[model samples]
Target: MDNQKPSSGGTFKKFIIALVAIVILALGITGVVYYLRWFGPNVTDKQEYLYIHSEAGFNDVYQTIREQGIVKDTTTFLWAAHNMNYVGRVKPGKYRLKEGMSNRKLINMLASGAQEPVDLKFRGLRLKTQFAGYISKQIEPDSVAIISLLDSAKFVEQYGFTTENVYTMFMPNTYQMYWNTTSEQFFKRMYKEYENFWTPARKQLAAAINLTPIQVSILASVVDAEALHDDEMPTIAGLYLNRLKRGIKMEADPTVIFATGDFTIKRVLNKYLSTPSPYNTYRNTGLPPGPIMMPSVNAVKAVLNYKQHNYIYMCAKEDFSGYHNFATNVAEHMANAHRFQQALNERGIKK
Candidate 1:
């Protein structure tokens, strides 16, 4: 029953202790909240990939991230991004979205421009427009953008190619590139690959054949179109080389097909041959202004190492085995052509 009043200093010390405890508790709660917001799993389970387009601003990125519903929480991500100074550092690219990604990791990845590389592959493309369309699907630039660069004489000229011969610069192969590659960058990359492909040996082989690299591509395109089987590429190449040597027109059916712009033609009629296009090897001598299609590597090689042969005429084998019947004389070629025509007539492949 003895109660003594405490001193003012003791009461002040008690208040101070309580204040310190409250401050510590508040700090701990704040730290925990921030940790959960910034370091906790943010990505949803539904998305496996996220694509950010070129020149995307922070608002655009946030809109996409939220609209995709991959990020489990958006407000927290925005806060984290702001604190990390990532608001202005949005990098456009393709990114893999994981099932469980933290805001910090995602923000860091985007801010640092860590984009996935796309595997761009093209082969046997018929036209420059076709090439542009194929490339548009693999990267950031659209078909129109690619076509603009492909059609630009000035732009392609810097790469030592006219617009007509620019098709040769793009070799058929798989190339690894950033998804956000510009059209100009894509062309430069292709040009570099083209240079790499045409080594000193390949150049010497082209020289030996009295053909420029582009001319080789042109001839290879014809060879590729002529032979359905790879085994016969060298033979077809040799036949064309023989024709060139003899000053005879190539009279290639594929060139007629190219001239008519009718890929569905199973048989090239006399009318088709007289289409009067520059690509018509029947009417024009030497290589066409450009390749009719993107020639394969094997086709180009076939032209470089053409088979030695005296046969200058070839017709598709009547057996339909994708083999050709070779002839050293016009009479024999006519017989072969007659047999092939009979076979085609039996198959009902008119026109």
Candidate 2:
């Protein structure tokens, strides 16, 4: 065989090819690692709402995330958060985590403060305690936090409300607000909403009725509680207005039930009516100091535009149809009351 010297050029070319291949492989592997750290699915299936408290620092948020096991790999998430500049910017909110969300997307959501809103709807909440408890479940602040403002005479006075009448500020509606809203912020927001609700026209209507906006709301609460059907609110409101003009006691059984602090009472008894409270309209000659419950819009409007009539007394229909029978005298009212009482007895609704 003829001996040929191995060409140096050929040998160099093979070496070059191997080196390039190795370099390309190394680069590909690095790219994959980077992708895993930055763009890969990091959120775990344990996806639940993450409530970042108001004014929470980065550490507190990170600790919450870590403790909750929100990410598949904590180390990778930490690296991604730092690299994406999400470490320093921590926003408080109610965040919902989706399964298989990339690390970058997760960091972006938290850093950008893109939070979910809570739906706060209040209707027939009879007590401040009930209202506070309802609010606490939707927001970060506890019930105690809300009650402190509701009961603070000085705080409520600044908003043109007394501690006893602060409930009038919040009417029945679905309010959209952030979960991180502080208690003070909630009160301010409700006051703003209240102000918006009482427009100049509505205020004029309230003035024409010989009542302030708050007094109207207080009367509306009684109307709201007494009338199960919205259509009857106007007639019921007129009856109460007649009583107001005649210097007669309201004798609102709902007010008496509210005064007793027992919402479970299906029928108001004499004992319950005798409960000692400023809210008890039975002994009182006018509307209670505050709203018995958060008034509905219909009820509030009913008071403002109450039908002109001589109906000074009203009673629930004995048929349990949630309607009330109107009367102009105590005799007719007592007859209506007797029938309702018999119905209540038949139904065994004794309190």
Q: lDDT per residue, candidate 2, 210-263, as tens digits? A: 999999999999999999889889989988988888889999998988888877
Model 1 Cα RMSD, Å? 3.1
Per-model TM-score, in order, reads: 0.91, 0.94
Q: How many backbone clashes does candidate 1 have?
A: 0
Error of 1 at 142 (Å): 1.1
Identify the runs in model 1 with alpha carbons over 4 angstroms from their true place. 1-32
- Compute the lDDT for candidate 2: 0.90
